[model samples]
Target chain A: MEVYHLYSGGKDSSLAAYILRKIGYEVKLVTINFGVLDSWKYAKETAEILGFPHEVVFLDREILEKAADMCIKDGHPTNAIQFIHEKALEEVAKLEGVERISDGTRRDDRVPLLDQRKTRSLEDRFNVQYIRPLLGLGYKTIRELTERLFIVEVKESEKLEKSDYEVELRHLLRERGIDPLTIFPKKHLQSRVIGWKKEKAHL
Target chain B: MEVYHLYSGGKDSSLAAYILRKIGYEVKLVTINFGVLDSWKYAKETAEILGFPHEVVFLDREILEKAADMCIKDGHPTNAIQFIHEKALEEVAKLEGVERISDGTRRDDRVPLLDQRKTRSLEDRFNVQYIRPLLGLGYKTIRELTERLFIVEVKESEKLEKSDYEVELRHLLRERGIDPLTIFPKKHLQSRVIGWKKEKAHL
Candidate 1:
């Protein structure tokens, strides 16, 4: 009854972990690291704040490089981010004792999204349950829940420091003398769950 | 926050109510009664065993009649059941102080299924959140979770005395001199959650 949730140190994934635990699953927050930077540490810190055991799974560095190339070629990050996400899920699915894997992808998410067909295929191949607790909840409901349950810090996507795949992808572009801002979209605000509203912890 | 879950005394909806409560929502199980039969009482009893408040919302008898007519004409119960399910949700959505509504429709449900567009429309029109916690879980995962968490009785569809919409629909057809077996598919097994597995209740 343990589910390894893909953690990004953000409100949505944090909430997914919370809901999974509430519904009787032991949640282990996992951040996939690809050697691009120590980004997973940020997620580890947030996981500690949320009071869940945290782990860093090492994905092939080549995968991040390929995603970076795709981002640079398309000047958009959607496809590349989605690529990394699927790879991360596959890695988790292959882990021992990991019969259930989950992510925070919501109904309104455009990037890093797994459609039902892909989800089913993963479940069938790995004999694991791929749970997306937020898939049925829309933007309005998610915002309302997070506002009540989490202490979040919102900043421009470029300035925000978190363990989501985007952080490493952006760094890869920078290493290759490319400004991530050019390939990555502008004016996007990202949120990081710094802590919980302690009063609502028991609820 | 409180959610009015469409309860049928079946494992799916019962689990939905349990999950909603575990996630910090006060759940009130609402069984929509069209007065075709007193089937809602069955759901009320199960809700009592699960330790949640229960209420019966009466819908227009005309709606059930219309669904029965559809069943007789088509010689199949799919469209008829879907019609009644939609009507039931509408009745719940229109209730005063009902800001959130939920159902047990799972990933593989065909009849009475609400596609994203239809769900969004209901939410927009009613100004309420339509929650479906089981929509992302496929048959295997759901069966596993229910077996672990609930004490359920499995019986042939016709013999199962539960509060699901199909029960009332069958009664309506029978009242109109139809065998109900002629229009409803056979050999389908239905489940009723008689109680929770006491040892796993808190989890």
Candidate 2:
């Protein structure tokens, strides 16, 4: 069966794709572009390096603004990001032949998490399965997997030119004269997969 | 500046050595041979492949017998394995110029665990540091590192002709008319580092 993987070109997403492919699944990389600048470039490059069939889906810019407003009202981005993730999953589930959806949500991930209730609701509503291959792993394991599988460039999320939905939301909030620090936490790490190498050497 | 590593020729130990080397430590691989068959061979071979200074310390057979007896009396090998491990550490600590000791005890490992109390006591007694480079890592990470770093041969602990201290203890127990099944759990997995290739890729 085919699995639609939500990939962001980050270490977690790349490793998640590697895992799905390793387990004998046909993986199609799906990147949701929220009309953000440079958001889709790294993911597209990563998909090419990994040699996976890839697609980019565009979401309305207003969705990101809505998410930012919700974060401002709630004083946290947890629920807002979760809502965006749910919408993305809903959109992807509608695609033909996408019987399953997967992401690289590890055990320690906080934001963009689809809660159990929402996960169940999505499964019931869409008749599609949701899989998180890296859920059993943690940050250390994910980093190690990335180190072994690819040549990645890691930096603080705030410093990266390539952006995710959260980054786009932060930009939108700033553009509206709102300081993103008032809504978002500080010091998160992300990576871009530049290339890969074959497994070699003992020790 | 110099660290003595407990080398078992398994994935964890090899990765521990790799981490130590990566961090600019002078690594010395110390293998304890408790007069068990094939206990030291793989370790010796791995040290050669990794091009590190190595030593095999001959432990008295009586130590294995005592550990096995303790397991039989306690109905579990946890304490017995801990005892042997402590002894191994004490012996390695006595080596000249060895200012630190390290192991490949990962976050998910249950067996051969050194509790906080024991760890503090060892440090206080030896006046040396103890490090577990893989302590923050889990099995998934270790396995991925091994797959990338070496060509390995994995088998069930029981089926492998190469033996560790625990295997020797089981054999000793069986010879004394005690079924190891009663004392040891089933389905333990271990691997031998048969060979290695130079790391060719950046990841």
Candidate 3:
């Protein structure tokens, strides 16, 4: 069975591919790179290091323009680009009866969807299998797996550029104590007030 | 130092608390039970077994119902309910001054934000440290740890309701010989095209 992993060449995706390969499956790596970034910064390089066939789906100006339009028209969140990647996955899923397109998203991410929401019914439509090898995994094991495999470490080249949103947000929310996961748009606050003061506070 | 673990009562979460206690931290267990789901199915039972203070935040009918409505109205696939759970964590973050909110979401869950879709900023806003003890850990190790602690086995649980849409779609799509994660509500196909088509195909 041929499986395509949504590769990103980072600790998570790299570890995910390692585990899938170890489980005795012919795996191919695929990464949807945004034009602004190195696109294949980590994903392609790692796929090369692992000696696996890799595909890079470049997000051209048209793709970015459409994304910006979606965000503006639908009031999509600033990070709604995942939906685009999901769309790219569909293009890949149509490969010669390819049955499954896998990803590295693990159980530990605990991240919310773009627009501060979660994808509900997007899956049934795609008509492909999204396998997350690390769904039930923990961070500690992934680190150990990386260490064991001697997969290329998170080198300067593999890391996200300073402009990468993941890197930017990680710094803001994680290091700066912003807690983006809990913060929401104006509308979210007007509704259910969790621990907020009735009027003065914004979520 | 005060720390809170997002407990789902799953073995992974159970081990998180167990490991933390072993290391000796004043740990508080917070369980989020979306009202739409069987909130305390295995989680509550698991928490009872371990003797940890379990605080469950239910997504009131108002919350999830409204979220489902927004999804339909906007033609966007989203789960606002999960955001509420994140919001609840912020409350916990504030109440306990918990510098960190650790979860069972592992390393593969690197897609903390939608690739190009949206962003979750709550984790940053609250200054709450979000830690995934298992981020580097694997499922096999998790199973081993559960057994080592004499916790309930995975085999005992007949059904585990998931929180992520991609995983749920994976199951449904796999059942129908497709990959759900691919069509992750990308603009290529509207909900009518994907959701109804899959539903029709299923029947």
RMSD of each: 1.6, 8.8, 17.8
TM-score of each: 0.96, 0.51, 0.37
Inter-residue clash pairs, candidate 1: none
Query: Which 10-residue span in candidate 3 chain A carries the lowest summed lDDT?
Result: A189-198
Q: Candidate 2, B186: how far from true, in Å?
A: 3.3
* lDDT (10s digit) by residue, model 1, range B1-203: 98999999999998878878888788999998988789999999999988999999999999989998999999998898889898889889999999999988887788778887898899999999998888777787788788888999999989988998888889888888999899877888999999888765844
Among incorrect, acceptable, medium and high, the docking class of model 1 is medium
Ranking by lDDT: 1, 2, 3
**DockQ of candidate model 3:** 0.03
True contacts kept of 2: 0.00
User: Candidate 1 chain A: worst 10 consecutive residues by lDDT?
Assistant: A194-203
> Could you give candidate 3's per-residue lDDT for residues A1-203 as a string of tens digits?
56777766556666566555543347888776556556355555555656679887654445545554444444433444455555556666666666566666654453322111122123345555555565544454445444544434332321323222233222333343544344324332111001211221111
How far does residue B93 in candidate 3 sit from its true spot (Å)?
Answer: 26
Candidate 1 wrong stretches, greater than 4 Å: A199-203, B199-203
The whole-model C-alpha lDDT of candidate 2 against the native structure comes to 0.74
DockQ of each: 0.65, 0.04, 0.03
Candidate 3 local Cα displacement, residue A134, angstroms: 1.1
Query: Scored by Cα lDDT, where does model 3 land?
Result: 0.48
Q: How well docked is model 1, in DockQ terms?
A: 0.65
